[model samples]
Every structure is written in structure tokens, then in C-alpha cells.
Target: MGTINELLVNIEQYRLLGYAAVFLLSFLESLAFVGTVVPGALFVVFAGSLAAKGFFDLGDLFWFAAAGAILGDGVSFRLGRRSTIYFSETNRLFKPSRLARGQEFFARYGGASVLFGRFNGLIRAVVPFVAGVAGMAAGRFYLWNVSGAVAWAASHLVAGYLLGTAWRTVEVWTTRFGALLAALVLVILGVYLLKRFFVRRGRLLLAFAGSLLGSVGEAIITNPDVRTFVAAHPRLCAFLAQRFDRQRFAGLPLTLLGVSFLYVLLLLGGVIEDLLASDPIVAVDTRLDNLLFAFREPTMVKLFLWVSQLGRGTIVVAVALTVCGILALWRRQRYILPFLVTLGGSTATALLGKVAFQRPRPAGVAVYREWSYSFPSGHAVIATALYGFVVYLLWRRTAQWGQRLNIFFAGLVLMLALGFSRLYLGVHFLSDVLGGYLLGLLWLIIGVSFAEWRRAEWGPVSAAVPFRSRAAGAVLLVGLLAFFIRTGMRALPAILPANGAAAATVTVPAAAIAEGLSRNRLPPYTESIAGDKQQPLSLVVAAGNEGALTAALRSGGWLPVEPVSFTTVARAAWQALGGGFPPVAPVAPAFWAGRPNDFGFARPLALAGGKPGREEARFWRTPLRTNGAAVYVGVAERIVGYEWGLFPRLGADLDRARDDLVRSLAGSGVVAVSRKIALSPPMTGETLAGTPFFSDGAAWFVEIRP
Candidate 1:
């Protein structure tokens, strides 16, 4: 690596040296035998950083890196193809010892050894040489060798460019930079936690995302009114809709009979159903056959399939819910404590089952549908945790026992909605959803029971019981335990060190890893964000035009951000971050701006009659809906908790009284209707929702036309 770095540096010091040195160094480094002794990592990294700083062109370093790699591998290939006879029976120019070592590894691991060997320092170069001698084709050998070289070069070069070169510049802004980084991290974690907390409290963004995709399916089906206007366009209708007549139910009875038989075998026969290949509950045997038939018509099924992929499970959902709980706590919402209890119980129950089962998935399951490992369904458990706890959380808030009973029953419906989605998508089995519900219910029972018992011991939930001394003691104990572990690990160096006389080489002790790590991480400090940016940054603007706006707000220490994201992010980001849109100002006179429209005029005017607001007061009030999409309204007050619905337009009415309470927020003394407002925009893009999941990919993009 050092030698390679020098070669890169010399290329700029002298043009001829740059070209020649790069070519030769790359060839040797990537070559079969000579690459072993050649050193280049430090040189390439140093050159990469220098290039980033404008001392040399970054492209020069990249070319040298690539040229060196290509030439080296090409030479190795030639050597392998031509020198197989001489090398196999007897070694000449190369040491027989090195080739002897390579043959052993190659034979044991086969083709994979060629790829993985690029990282094994002791035998990387020699293994290729052995591959040559072992009759590997030049084309196949080059493929793996080149792939490894490109990845290897890109990794080091990128690292040097980002961490080494850039970190050096960032080192100067240590104080403020650390503060900003910490604050940003906290804000992100906060947002994530808040979203998760809200989700657990019944704000289902995942559901919304899924619903968006399903709307597409529902759209395609209803667009031409195939069900209604089929007679008008018979040919088009026949193609668009599944024409069901006598054959529509051709195998229906058989399917139900088979399903019943399978269920009986599963529950009563005591047979090992897995061995019998009886797995996965289907509503009917013909379901798969129908699915297959639909799949055969790729265009028709693509939209439905896309919806299922949209429901990709995210820990972010959980994290956001936690953050929401934190906000609820900060606001002292009555629902706060119960929300946390529900989430805590849900998480504990779900995770315990996942660990307990550790069940393997069915073969080709993921390939067919987006299937994760089976256990108690996360959806079911989380749902139960929230809704079951909701009953207790709202116990005292409700005025009547009937109302409580109504809410309890409603909560059950929600849990079913969540639990059923898991099975509807075929991601979980019947038992998985059922087990999840039981697990969640069981945990809920225990939590409620424990809380009931501890209520007297802990005092009222609203009362704050401060304990400074106990907190200090706990913090100190943790610090001491961490220190003890550090000392134990450090002491281990004296007892153990690699001892290998056969490989005559310098041995680095494991203890040295600690020192090396520290040196690598710690950089010289500075106090500026400008000098800190020795290399221009490739800013990743994730928030669309919002990033453009934020970049303008940045101090002179930074420049305009180079956006890397697409347009859709602006919509999502706007929603997630108290999202909003600029006022829809008119191009001309803007009549509504000067004079209130029916929306505003109707509100206050409605107060003039017998009812205070219903008459003239109607001129001042506007209706708002709680659509499932995330929303932010620049209203005079929060409508969710207050002014819930339009009521009798009277000063003495519930809405009018509640309006006085919520008209102001924590920061603002008076809330006013602001121009900027956020509404749950129609969803766009890929998500995990209604349909099914993927066989191989971690994420997927849903295709929908506006």
C-alpha cells in the first residue's frame, strides 16, 4: 500500500513517472505472484486525499488505480495460461512454497476461493498465481479478479476521500461541529420516536402507504366501469375483467372440500403436517391456481403485487411511536403513560415470541411472497398491545360505562384490522396471528395486573417523584462496570500473542488493535467550518426543495447543497416534519386574500341567528377532516384534541369552550390561521401494504401513474 501510494504521488510529481509508475504498480499489485511483496494502500490513500485537496486530479489517482489493477490481472491471466506446466510440476521464478499453499485453498473452496482470497493478505497474490497453474480459464479468472480489484480500489479510495481527507477538514470545527452533530442526531431520533409513538397510538402511516397502492388496484378495476358497462364494450370488457360464468366456480366445491380435509388433518389427525407438505393456510385450494392464472396475465397482476411490497416492516415505525410518546409525555397528555405501557408490553411480547420460536421459513416462501421468519405476528402483537391498553388508559376519562364498553369493542375492531392484514397478505400463518394476539393479550393482562398492584406503591401516575441520589448511584455503577471490562480486555495482551515460526514475519499483538483504532479515529482539532472543508463536499440533499431552502439558511461556512434526491421526497418530508405547503397565492387579484370566501365568510356569519356560531359565527369556522394521511393544519388550534367536530353554533357549546382552551399552544400565546398548512397528500411510490412481499430485495419501488 505504501509503495502504491508513492507511485500515485510520483505520477503528479512527474507526468511520465505518473503514467509508468501507475501502470506497473497496478499490474504488479493485481498480478499473480509479484503483487505479494508490493505495497500500495498507504500510497493510494495519500494520493486520493491529495487529489481531493486539489494537489492532484482525483481522476489521475482513479485511472492509475484502475490501470494498475487491469494490467496486473491481465499479466496474471497470461502467466496462468502459459506457465501451468512449469508451475504445477516444479516452481522456477516463483517460490514453490507460495504456489503449494495456494493449491490447497483453491481445491478446498473451489471458485469462491478466487473471490474471497483477494482479502486474505497472506495468500491473495499467490492464489491467483495458483489459479493460473491449476488450469483456470483466462476469461473466468479475469472476471472475478477484476471485480475484486475494482471493489477493493473503490473502497479504499472512497474511504480516503471521505473519512481521511474530509474528516481532517471537519476536525477544525470540533466544538460546534460535535454540538451540531449531536443536536441533529437527537432531532432525528426525536422525530423517529415521535412517529413511532403516534403509530402505536393509532396513527397508521404504514396503513396509509399501503392504502395508496391498493387504490391503484381499485382504480384499474373501476376505471372503465367494467362491472357496469361491460355490455357496451364486450371485447374490451372481456380483456379487462375476469369473465366469470360457469367455469368461474369450476373447482370451488373441490377447493373447499380439500381445504376442510387439510384443516381436519392439521387439527385432529396429529400428523406432522410439515412432512406431509401441508403448510400455509389458504382460503381455498383454488386460490393459488387463480393467483397463477392472474400472474400469467402479467399486466393485470403487477399493480396488485406492487401493493403487497409496500408494507415493508420498518423499525422506524416503532422508533417514531416512541418519540410520539415522548412528545405526549412532554405535553402531559392523559394518554401518554398508557401509550408507553402498551408499546413496552407489545415489544416485550413480540420479541419474546420471535426469540422463542426462532422458526425457519418454508422453502421458496420468500420467493413466492415477501415472507420474513414466522413467529407471533408483529402486527397482531403491536395492535393488541395498543388497543387492549387503550381500554385501561381511557377507563377514567370516559363518563359512562357504556361509552367505555363501546370504545373497548371499537379497539377490538382495530386489533382485528391489524392482525388480519398480516394473514390477508399471506405473510403469516393462522397460528402466527392467533399466537400473536394471545401473546399480546397475555402480556397486557400481566401489565395491567402489575400496574393495579403497584398503583398504591407508586402513588398517582400524574405525580412526579424525583430521585436525584438514586440516579447518580446507578450512573456511577454502570461507569465502574464499563471500566472493569476495559481493564480486563487490556490485560489480556500480556498473556496472548501469535507465535508462528514457520511464517517468519512480524506479529502484531491483538492489544495493538486498541492503539491503532484510537490513532485512526482521533484527528487534530480546529475551530472553523470553512478551512474544515479542504475538499468540496458532495452534499446529499434528501429533502428536495426543502434542502435547497435549508442550504440558503446555512452560514457562509457552507455553500449551496448539491441535491441528490428526486422530487417525491419533498412531499413526504413535508408531511413527516410538520410538513406544509406554501400558501396558494393567486397569480392575479387573489380575490380570497382580499375578501374571505365562503369558507371563512360562512363561519362567523353563522353566529348571527339563534345559535351564536351557526348564524354569523359560521363566517369564522371551517371544516377539517381527519384523513389517514399525515397532516398539519395551520389552524388557530389543534382540532384532533379540541373542536373535534362541528357543534351547535353557541358560545356556550362544547366546541366553543374547547376552542378557547386549545387556541394557544406551548410556544404561541395565540394560534392563528397561517397560510402554510400540511395535508395528507395522496401517497406515491413503493411500499409494503395490501398485496405481498418480494423474494429477494430488501426494498421495492411501486409504479403508479399520476
Candidate 2:
């Protein structure tokens, strides 16, 4: 870490080398044949990220990358203009099939193919070569080539820069949120990559599948057994054929919708059954509620409160009316009835489910008091139904597959955000939101099926509405937007007060503290995100508050772990990279009862050959208390060395670290009283990070002096 820091500090000395590296990478990434083998784009992105950290100039990096990209493409174009022999069928790098696909792409898009193809990895390498071979004018080729190179450089570099800038913030929040933010990021990235893959290869995949299925279908129909069965049951075969006919709405489309409806209906039933049976899901709900309650920030609460209001009854109804008005003006009135029914039915279902179940909203943890029952979340239901219908309407009107996909994903994101807001605000449990989604999906499929049937029966409508009617639709949309803004402003004030409320504290009698520890009134071990047991609790401390407890540890030579921030993180990295250990390095968080430890402290250790080690401890404040003092349960371990010069490697002797902490506190002369007590049987376990540890399960009970 220190070595890397020093290099970054003096990076200007190697500015020329950095630029050359960037130029070469971008050049190779765009070069035909070579581009297919090199992962230059990834390196260019990393360079941009380094620039964001001040290791290089962003402008310089951009120019070098863009220039290299342009020159590389020009060279590939020249090579193509010179000869056709190298790109034959037998050439492994430039196969005839790949070249043919490139030619097709170029023919379809013309010179703009250069611009469009720049972003697609496989196509990027081949398009320039195809452009040159087609005898395209030099002027037109460079115009598109330069435009593409500049745009590509800017986009990739900007992405990397943003990621680098957000890394510090993500790191800090990750400790607080406990993998939630990280997991969310990974999911979003994965979805984006998957979407891109399908957009690029979907047509080819569909064509391939169609051919394969057609062949199989023909063989099946030609079979002797199949012919005999068909001859015996002509009516049954006709009915089956009619059901699968793609041209009719009541056929393949309706069958698919029916299947989807049944699947969602079953899921809804399962959620209801689990609720009634008090299953493990119910247990998870309580834990999650408590976890989110502990981690709520005022800023986040306000943000989610605003998001939640998007699903308000008035807002959804107003938007629905606006959409209906637009549809009527555009001669899409056939869709209006189904659309309204979908939203209305979903809302009614949620309200009815609430009344039938009478399930109370999460108590004490809720940011705002909700008067209605929470068996099925109204916000989740409305968001799903309203946005889902809107997506369907837009998808139906869109001709381009890409635009349709974008509309679908946009609606999906909105529905998910609104549903998540309800969870974040503590207004509903997991089961409630899930049930609402399933119920909403059920209605959505019905509404879409009906709309499709209507379209099929009535034939296509080509009547274009007048300019006046279109203008009126636009006005209605603007009015709806204005009303939505007004409603949001009014709703903000109602949730503001609730955001200021503190989480309620629980107290246990002093006499019960020891017995409670033995009986596991609190969890006996640390927890992972999935609620699995991790390291056992091996230390307990009683203090008036966190301040006194930290003070005693500080006096005993234990330094509090630094809170994650850019400067602290950089400093820690520098130290670790230089093979020097910092006393107050930030520690990776461990959870207990779904919440990360409330405090962390480490005592530096000197080892053989002057190596650095530390005794690390993490403590969580339990609901249990002794007299008026807060009770804290903790796990302790020894950091033996650095793992890959970044993460701290831990020692297996959990008991030794616990003993060291007790001895340090006892010798500090601040202890009122302290004793070792058996908390659990001897056990072995691994931490959330998968570091193995063993312990005698005996814990120190330390009371701090007043």
C-alpha cells in the first residue's frame, strides 16, 4: 500500500510511460485480428480509473486513447484495401463466416456502422476491415471512424472515472449496509451485461432455435406412431393445433399468459400459507425489520419516502387517467378498459388481503404510523400494476426491439424501487411486499391477455388521430406531471417528522445479564447476511455507555478502528502496501443479529523478525443490560499477517485474543470488577470471511469503573 501510494504521489515522473501505455492498449484493442486476442478495453478502463485517482491526467489519457483508436482503425482499413487473401475461410483469425456477418452489418448500417460497431467487442474488430474491403470512400470512413473513436473513448473513460470516484463512497457504505449495496451493484451490472448480450445475439439465437425446432417438429409429424395417434384422435389434434396457433390471440399468447398467471397465483398462495404457519420466513421478517431499523439514515429515509409517494393512490389514479386520455385520442381506446381493470383490481386485492389477514405493520421500527393492515403492501401492488401496464402499452407501440427492451427494463426498475422503498421505510414486511407483487402480476397478465384478444378480434387500427387530438393528449400528460409534483411536495411533510424518531431501546435487569448470557437471550454468535452463525461471542462488557467502554480500551493501548473515508482508506492502503501496519486501520464489519458491530478496537502486536500483527475485536451493543449499563457482546481474534497485502489474515486462537483483551483492560486500573465465565461449550467455527477459528467459549465479564 505504501509503495503504491508513493508511486501515485510521484506518478508525474512517469507521465510519458503512462501515456504510451494507454495509447498502445487502445490501439491494440481496436486493431483487427490482434483486437480479437487482446483485452485492451479493460486495461484502458483501468487507466482511466487510475487517472481519476490523480495518478495521470484525464485529458491526456483521453487524447492518447482516442488517437490510438483512430490510427489503429485506419491501419486495419488500409490492410483491408490492400488484399483479400488474409481473410479467407481457412484463416483462423479472420474466418469467412465472421467476415460475412461483418459485411452484413456494414451493409445494413452504411458508414454509421463504424460508429455503432465501436461499442460491440466482436463487431468492433471486423467492421473496419469490412469497410475498407468494400472500397468505401476514405473521407466517409474517417469521418465515422473518428466520431466513433472519440465517443468510445469518452464513454469508457467516463464510466471508469465514475466508478473510481464512487469507490470510496461504496467502500464506506458497504461496512454500514453489510453487503446490501455491493450485492445490488453486482445485480445491476449482471443485468446490464445480460441485456446487452441478448440485444446483440438475440436474432441469431432465435433463428438457430427455430431451425432446430423445425427439423425436430417435421420428424415428429412424420413418425408412424404419431400418424396413427393423429388418425385416431383428429379432434384432439385439431384442438391442440388451434391452441398453439401463433396468429390468434386466444392461442399461443393466451396460453403463455395463463401459465404465468397460474405460476404467480401459486407463489401468492405459498406466501399466505407461510404467514399463517409462522414459518422461517416470518422469522426472517423480524430479523430484517430490526436490521434495517438499525441502519436507517435520515437522508436515505427522505429519499425512500419520496420514492414511496410515487405509488400513492392519488398519483397512480391520476397517471392512469392521463394514459387513458392519451390512448383514447390515439385510437387505442381498446386498451383503456383492460388497463383500468388491471390497476383497480390489483388495488382492491391488496386492500381485501389486508382486511382478511389483519396483519399488523412492523411495530416500533416503522418510520411512520400506517393505519391500515400490512398483509399485502398497497404501494407494491399499485407500483407493479400501474407501471407494468404502462410498459405493456409502450412496448406494443414500439417497433424497435431495443426500444421495447428499454421500456420493459425501465418499468421493471421503477416497480422494484417503489417496492423496496416500502421495505426500507419499515411500513411493510418482506412477505407483504412479495404477496403484493404476485397479486399485481396476476392482474397484469389478465389485462394484457384481454388487450391482445381484443386486438386480434378487431383487426389492426391504422386511423391516425388529428393534430388537435394529439395536442390535447400532450396537455393532459403535462397536467398529470404537474399534479404529481404537487402531490409529492404535500406528502413530503407528513413523512419528515417520522424520520427524526430514534429506534427504541430495550433494557434488561442487571441480575438477568449473566443468566441471559448463559441462556442465549442474545444470539450466541455473529451472523452473516443469510443469518448463518459465524464467530461465537467470546467477550462481554458492561459500561454506562459506549464512551466509557471505548475510553477504557484506549487507556489500555487499544486504538479504535478508523471510520472508512477516502483519506483514511488511502492512508491505510499506503501503510499496508509498504509492509507497515497502522494501529487504527479500518476493519471489515461482522454482523450480530443482522446488525454490524457497534464498535471496533485493535491492539498492535510485535512479532518475530519485527513483523506487525494486531489483536482485533468487534463489539455489538445487545438489548440486554446490567443495572443501568449497556451490555456489549464481542468477538476477538489476532491478525497474524496481511492477506495479499490488502486484507488482514487472522490467527485461529480466538481464546487467546479474548484473554489478551481481558488482561489489557484489567491492568488498565479502570475495571470495577471482572471475571471469566463459561458462556458456551468449546466450539470451532469460521467467520463471515471464511477464516477458521476455535474457542473455549469462556468469556470475560468486565464492568467499567464509574
The best candidate in terms of TM-score: 2
What ranges in model 2 sit over 4 Å off?
1-97, 101-191, 278-280, 463-465, 493-512, 518-520, 562-586, 605-613
Tens digit of per-residue lDDT, candidate 1, span 1-706: 1223455566656865644555566666667755555545545665566555445566666777876876676667667767753443343226677777778888987666676776665567767767776788777877877777776667656666654444433322111122333534655565555444433422232344455557886786677665567667888766534432223322333344345445533442221232134332322212322222211222322322332221223332433354344335433344455456656766765777677666543222122443356666776776666556656655644656456555665566557656644543345655566656656665565545444434434444643423653355355546544644454344321211211112222222222322322333311111111112011010111111223222321321112211112232233234324422112111000011111111110112122233222111111101111111111111111111102121111222222322332222212322222121111122222111111111111111111111
Q: How many clashes show up in model 2?
A: 4
Q: Could you report the Cα RMSD, in angstroms, for every candidate shown? A: 36.0, 11.9
Per-prediction backbone clash count: 69, 4
TM-score of 1: 0.25
Compute the lDDT for candidate 2: 0.79
lDDT of each: 0.41, 0.79
- Clashes, model 1: 69
